[model samples]
Target: MTHTSTAQTTTDEFIRLGLDVLDTELTAIDGLRRYIDADFAHACELLLACTGRVIVIGMGKSGHIGGKIAATLASTGTPAFFVHPGEASHGDLGMITAADVVIAISNSGETNEVLSIAPLIKRRGVRLIGMTGNPQSTLADLADVHVCIAVEKEACPLGLAPTSSTTATLVMGDALAVALLHARGFTADDFALSHPGGSLGRRLLLHIHDVMHKGERIPLVDESATISQALLEMSRKGLGMTGITDAGGKLLGVFTDGDLRRILDQRLDVHQTPIAQVMTRQPITISADVLAAQGLKLMEDRKINGLFAVDADGYPQGALNMHDLLKAGVL
Candidate 1:
């Protein structure tokens, strides 16, 4: 065979192998739907009732999945953390308390490291939820509740490495976390509290008022002010827009760089014309109580770069630009 033909054959085999792995794993995950039964409910109940935390324990690949499960639980309103079974046997067992619930993951349900620490966990009277592919395994029989992550077969061609089994276990972990999340009436705001350091947290929890320029930083021009004065206010504030307010400080209109362009096109005298005549009446605005993400959406959808945070009475309380959202991690 030519070199090009050999290379084509190799690439085709790789694609075939990858698709086979995915198809096998997809079948395994789909089979998990039936396992969300009473036993799963019991596990979720045990986790929800615990006042302390969910202690996830496993060995090897199971340990990696357990860590992710613990993180998902914690971020979704269930206080949980991972404890390596080997470490637990040595000293980390102290972290598990009677108020805490244990989630033990083992493909065979006979992992030595996990089984070694099982007795100590049992002695503490902590609730144990076993996640294993083997329902008949020792870990399953010993637990207060068992969640079967049993898969028909491993996606690994040799059946020696974990592939389908681990995916099923991870999906089972997600099911447990989501069940508890809904049971506890968890909201996006609640999820945001645990994830305050990330983009998701900023989108859900950061409010417009948190990032808006308030007080003197808000570019304001009197309705009677000349267009020249409005330009000076917009430039001084560097927000690309200025709010035109009445004598009582209630917002009347908005003059923006775009509005200035229109006036320039009309050959209107900036020095002779009043800002209100050139301003956009009933301009789009947002409330301070809304999230900064919503503010970003409003600016994007309206095809504008600047916005005013207004009160219910149409008074401009603050001003913000796209730069503010970017600076506050809300973009």
Candidate 2:
């Protein structure tokens, strides 16, 4: 017989434990595919028909997942909020209305705090949707629709803690949120409206003019300007590039740091070289009203770090670089 100390355990043994846990949880999630039938469809229907917010309630570990589910629902065009089941019996149950749908989460379907308010929720005529591991428990029996998140076993080696179960619950919640999102024809713009404080909002809402430098701040010079003058303009504006415009202010070309590198490689005299001789002709430009995200994509596709915003007639309106997008939270 062989014995090993905890410190002497090989790396392979430690990794095997982790891989086994992951395999167990993955199998648990796969098992849920069977439950995504009629009951799942009905659950989406119930939530889609909800006229008011979805009130999510659970105890302990379930509470944490409930909070995340509620946030996902709210952000994806469904109105929702989390209410502690313990607080519900103490009068928080009043927060629920007949028009609202209540989603109660309990692993065993026998959590006393949740069951305590089940009768109250039903008495008020609010639709109840129960998410539990045991479909035969009191919570499931009383629910209008039950979502079974039963896992074969917990990922925990002890077979006691909520591991695979919680992950399954979260996946089920995402399924509900996304199903409702599609049924409601929710668009990315709608999503941005809900997440106005995040980068997504900026990506969807910010326009070129909002982030681009205009007027004096725009690095511009006439096509006839010396390379030395172009460098001075680029340095003063700090955009690492300068736009060359014609007599009527229509953009003709652009000189960038890359062009400077090319000139240096060719040993051209920056002091006396003409800007028009080295500038990139009819450079790719973006519309001033387009989303900043489109501008970033254009810059990425063109393999450049900066670009000029133009009007309908191709006259330069503003200039911006990758840093501008970063500064405006549009990147």
Candidate 3:
């Protein structure tokens, strides 16, 4: 009864099309379960036994998938790289070594560039693992190990584009990398080591020292400093809190904006009142090596908004506030 505009119809059609593509890919990966033949195990075994690296080679769309798999493997504790099959004939094949394992991928299993290097890879004493839709094709026939990435059909309406086949290949590569990761006892720390420039790295590698203000820049004062002096220090450092230390430089308490408000409510004179009178005694402090996320958790659990960084002798050495977390993108 309703007439939809062409734009709206196109929008709906594309959304449905994308969902169909994802569903088709899921089904293809599920189908791989039945093909759990010895060929798959043999491929993994050859890669695991390799002494050097896993070199991935493919052409066209399959080449794109191979490149992504290579990057994934490289970042996940497995040494790998993608060498375009087209480039292998252009002198880049010299990058290949006898100690490497070769993974050749093709949907038709007869890509000329990929197949051309199969014999050379074998002649160099490298293990050849093939991922293909056709188990009987030339590339698979020449491989020492064949992995079937057969898809029932393409997500494309005409079954022309590579949708399900690429998904199956990616899933297989992930399986290999994760299995090898567990075999090598790779950990989250190891992952952080490989990704030290990203936010995930910052979350894992950052410590209190990296974010907390230290030295004279820290917001700190002696117990004898007046409330007015502490507030000045807090404002100067912009951390919203000041650490109150004893005569021996040991952490005695902390004074924050909250404490100031409470003192003001009691009509306390800032200029004459000693910071010790309004400071929170035995305030929660963190060590220099504490993680930023852990620090956030500690503050949240304690119902506090700030922290003092302390040393081995309970002496305050640095100060941090909620704003610091926000600035560091940890909030």
Candidate 4:
């Protein structure tokens, strides 16, 4: 029979226990700020000097954290990946090479599977970086560099579970990645290159010209065109708006589908009136080279769903609507 702790039977006691776990972790993180030393510096330098990819290896909980760290590093311009120590002993060790730097993770620093292949890693002339709670562990002693991720207490109430230790290890990994990112002078553009399918990549990759409907495909009419003619152009282009331009292609104003509906509701003469008289003046426009994502923001910010692409001299060159943004996945 399992012994039940009477103290944990109450809901308030359970809540306090949960809060205590978070408190311990928060306190440990706070202390980590001042613990930065030469080891952290050396880890960053070692990774910077690496000529090949980083091969991260760990077991159990550390393995999960290692995978995430590898993914973060890879996405942030550092090429790294996780490998299971158990699988490495079988055949995955072939993936390791002399040019690569190995990051070994184990809280106890004495995992049998990890230590079993430690010799082969060194034999292959691979640099080993150990992350562990114990400073004097065998893994640390055999490593070229050791990053201590020690925690004062476990967040687990049982105290035997990995909690604060894993958090500290993850923090150390992030610290290394950010340090390397700055050292390499990694920029947003570099990050966008790796995340082409993401919204951020869309913002960086797309420009106004790419989405803008140009040439005769754009809904456009001259200032002299009647409201009926402007409505026809708007319908033909299906952009729900028509731009008014002069003989020199300079934009004068815009007539939108909303304007047409409003005029019709008031029983205005569409056939007898000129579009220039009723057009919206000083309309919002964007440059062809402006980012499509920025164009989308402009539309949202100004409470408009469409924009006219204008030249440097304010001539209408292209047009786009919210549908274009949706198609480009910028919305």
Residue 112 Cα positional deviation in candidate 2, in Å, after optimal superposition: 1.2
Residue 103's lDDT in candidate 1: 95
Give the Cα lDDT of each candidate: 0.92, 0.94, 0.86, 0.89
lDDT tens digits by residue: candidate 2, 227-287: 9999999999999999998888889999999889877878788778889999999899999
* Ranked candidates, highest lDDT first: 2, 1, 4, 3
Tens digits of per-residue lDDT, candidate 1, 281-331, equal 988999999989999998999899999999999998899999999989888
TM-score of every candidate: 0.95, 0.90, 0.87, 0.91
Provide backbone clash counts, one per model: 0, 0, 0, 0
Candidate 4 residue lDDT tens string, 29-100: 776775478887988888899999999999999999999899988988789999999999999999988999
Which stretches in model 4 have alpha-carbon errors above 4 Å?
Answer: 1-14, 198-200, 261-268
How does residue 70 of candidate 4 score in lDDT? 93
**What is the per-residue lDDT of model 3 for residues 190-250, given as tens digits with 9 covering 90 to 100?**
8888888868887777777888888988888999999899989988988788888889889
Give the true-structure RMSD of model 4.
Answer: 2.4
- Candidate 2 regions with alpha-carbon error over 4 angstroms: 1-8, 198-200, 265-273
164: Cα error in model 2, Å: 1.6
Which stretch of 10 consecutive residues in model 2 shows the poorest summed lDDT?
Answer: 2-11
Clashing residue pairs, candidate 3?
none
Question: What lDDT does model 1 reach?
Answer: 0.92
The positional error of residue 124 in candidate 2, measured at the CA in angstroms, is 1.0
